[model samples]
Target: MRKWGPLFAVSLAAFMLLIDITIVIVALPDMASDLGSSYTDLQWVMDAYALALAAVLLGAGALADRVGRKRVFIQGTVLFTAASALCAFAPNTATLVAARALQGLGGAAMFATTLALLGLAYEGRDRGIAFGVWGAVSGAAAAVGPVLGGVLTEHIGWEAIFFINLPIGLLAIAMAARLISESYGDREARIDVPGMVAFTAGAGLLTYGLIRAGGHGWGDGLAVGVLVGAAVALAAFVVVERRTAKPMLDLGLFRRASFVGIMAGGLFTQFAAFSGFPQVSVWLQSVLGYGPVKSGLVLLPMAATAFVVAGAGGPVMARIPPRYPIGGGIVCVGVGALLLTMVDAGSDWPVLVPGLVVIGVGIGLSMPPMSAAAYASVPPEKSGVAGGALNTFRQLGFALGIAVVGVVFRAAVENSIDGTPAAGRDAH
Candidate 1:
């Protein structure tokens, strides 16, 4: 019980951070109206956090190892809490976007250190249970984000969604202080400055290009240049990482079959399923004529179902073969996405509920085994990097998923725009 206490606390903090990623999506329209944001700015509200998260994650793990995981975790919690306040009180889209980026920075620190902390704190069955609980919390949080955002946006304000993090953050901080002890690795690696620069720039350029292509046509020269530059920067990143004595990311982890497959599956599942929630939230509110609160209520079953399945998944995995649950889960997620494709302007709860449930279950089953497999395959020395890479890929999947899905959904909407006269066009 004592061993599991800190694990629970860190896992809880992770749950809060993951939840915020999706919570803001449902609140975006309300936020836009209040802040008077343009469509591009609204997209930035989502992208900025994701970009910052991906940018800092690789470095954050190394920093945690060099400094101390607990120390880094405390600093991150403080920063995240402060950033939440800034986001809650933000007066303009610019302020909110900046705050969200800060929040992501903190989140990267928190997430990167979390699993390492868990590994340090627990052993064997306790470790398994802790990770299982962590997985359940994450899935449940993702499932709840939409409903929570909707309810908060409708009842209090979009700001309430950000503000709610305050209590959770505070509690997690207190728990950390009480339950967790600090630990660090022996080797101290130098910062891979060039590698960080290349990776961040490459990811940013690619994401920016995708976002722009959603608004401007694909033929737009700036968009084309951005994408081209992204490819070049990524190539440079690969070169830089290989040559660096202390690489920000170890390139060797890809050699393990289990590691590679788990990472790939994680990316694929998130790319296919996780990206669709925000779009679904908007579709429910704008197209289905559902109120924010109602939209959230409609999503409650999905969250609830995921929580249950995810909680049970660990025990289930104990008895079953690893490949069966994970592979089956991936298939379930893909099938759910296919069903979701049936949703349109005229769809209702009946059409949305089944698909959401399928997705929730699929995600619940896939994530834990994949995560466990990734960790199991790595050498103990490289656990930190492996964990960071796994999370980096997961986050990258998220960012890429949103960018790609956003483009597809936006294009679909634009193409479907009927002969109705263009309404109040904003003065450029």
Candidate 2:
């Protein structure tokens, strides 16, 4: 137990943060009913956390490298625990969304430091064991998150999902303080505050604009203005990255074709596979009238398949050229998305099984190699930055994917339900 104490601490933090990514899907409807949330509020509820995570992830990494990984991790754990309490007690959708964003900031701090802390804590065979176990825990988080959330929401209420994190966060903090030692990377590494701010502004504005366009039309003056601001902010982000002395992401890496491909693969894998999940949960509960547990169970095949494939096939896939596995795997994801198009007003839950399984297979195949490929593309000194960049892109993809899918889904639903009996029903 002593030998693996660091693993326990880091894995606990990883599980808590990663599970939050999907745990809320099954509880969205319950939250809506309780909070009187609008459709846009529901979208923000999901996107706000993801957006904050994506935006802060790389900067957090840089900050950790300078300030000490263990110290930052503990601070993050404390903040995450406090934010979870805020989320549990939030009185409205706006407050909940704000709390969720705070949770994401804490999550970023923990996530950015976990691997580094593990690297510092272990060596040789023990390090390998620690990493393998941590990887399994990370994979399992997604698989179990919804089921756990469903059970908690059904039995204990939606707030239980957030409240559940409290004990886990506190335990992680205590374990980390007792067992984990401080470590640092480039002590001079600077947080790219301007770049983070610009990128976050751009992404947030873009999502807001899309949500606005869904209800108010693309030509709505406010939507158009926000979209234009998004463009300006994104452009400013690019400029800041190019000019900053120690950027969270080194923009020069994009000059490499392989690096670009790997980044794109990382981003779209999440977008193609998991982005529409919140909307799916909404359909299951509101349209199909499934309870939270049943709705969570409905999505289990994909995550289960993903876990099995990644564990079983990872070693074999590592032997081959990464491009084949990553490329073919993402293609599978796109095909699975196509398969999901079969879901209609009259379809049952099983319609999702085949698509989910395929996407799972894709995720299993692609994700294991993504980190290695990204690291290989850069020099040794830049490997950490590369890792941070890949994760940032992936989270950004999830955030943006949710916004885009929500807009399209709303439009399609409106078109299909026009003058129909379902049109009069509560879709929110």
Candidate 3:
């Protein structure tokens, strides 16, 4: 366990950051009431974080390589913890939204470096186990978000959701400083400023348009223009990456199908995660009237199962080709999503548990192996940038998943209410 210190530090830090990604879902209802936010505003509360993370992660990773991963990682902890405080005391929705964006910026820095830290600490079979453990912790944290969020939001108010981060972030920061040794990805890697600017504009604009279009109708001219502008900027970014001698994103990673597939797996896994969890939470609280604790308990099976399955996947991965286990895991998640679609307004906990378990199992199986493979594909010197590259896709997928869920939810509700009485709509 002594040798596990740095791993524990990185994992704990990651857990705190990952928890924030989904925790706000359960708190949204309370925030809506307190802040007088519309559905779009509530979606922004989620999107703002994802957008900022996606925008800056590539640069953050490169910065880690140029300077030191531990230095950037510690800085991220300070910024994230401070931003959480800002969020807790936010006076209004706009303040909360801005704070969330800052939190994401901090999270991007940590997210960019944690995997690199893990890689530095472990090797060969040990690296595999570390990834399994990391995946389990991350999967469990994400799965548990709504339940924790529900408990906090229900009892202490929505602000408590942000407040909950205070102790965790501070403790993680302290532990990381003491236990984790400093490392660099590449001392020679210069910050690619122009590449950073192009990717940030491209990713941020596109995601904003998607979030808006999901909450509002696609007919909005602003969404259309933003999307088009984003496309043009991303095209420009590709040109910049190809031309820059030391790019923020190594455009060359796309040359390998295996690496691209591993990254795609990250994208799909996050897409599955965000799209399903928050939507289900909305169904549980708003449609079914289950309280936070009870709803959380109902969702516990998935988290528990996922944690176990992820730990187990390491052994299975040792014997099989990595792709097989990863593919199998994604397939399990899809099956779970299918089962969850059968849920109705009056469905009980028994009806929900099976699907959650299946998805949990799938997440456990896929995330570890895919992550391991992603790290292995790049040279160790590029670890921070590589991790960032993979996560950029993951967070972008997360943002898109939320938008898709919002669109589906809105459309479904509109259709459900089209012919209903006003009282029935209110009751619904």
lDDT of 3 at 90: 94
Q: Please, what are the lDDT tens digits per residue for candidate 1 over residues 103-144? A: 999998898888778777766666667667777888788778
**Runs in model 2 with CA error above 4 Å?**
1-7, 118-136, 189-191, 206-220, 375-384, 411-428
TM-score of 3: 0.93
Residue 419 in candidate 2, Cα distance off native in Å: 11
Tens digits of per-residue lDDT, candidate 3, 43-81, equal 788888988888888778888988999999999988999
Every candidate's lDDT: 0.78, 0.77, 0.82
Q: Sort the predicted structures by TM-score, highest score first.
A: 3, 1, 2
Q: For candidate 1, give the lDDT of residue 382.
A: 48
Total backbone collisions for each predicted model? 0, 0, 0
Ranking of all predicted structures according to lDDT, beginning with the best and ending with the worst: 3, 1, 2
Q: What is the lDDT of residue 240 in candidate 2?
A: 91
Minimum summed lDDT over a 10-residue window in model 3 is located at 419-428
Error of 1 at 191 (Å): 3.4
Candidate 2: residue 322 lDDT (0-100) = 79
Off by over 4 Å in 3: 411-428
Candidate 2 least-lDDT 10 residues: 419-428
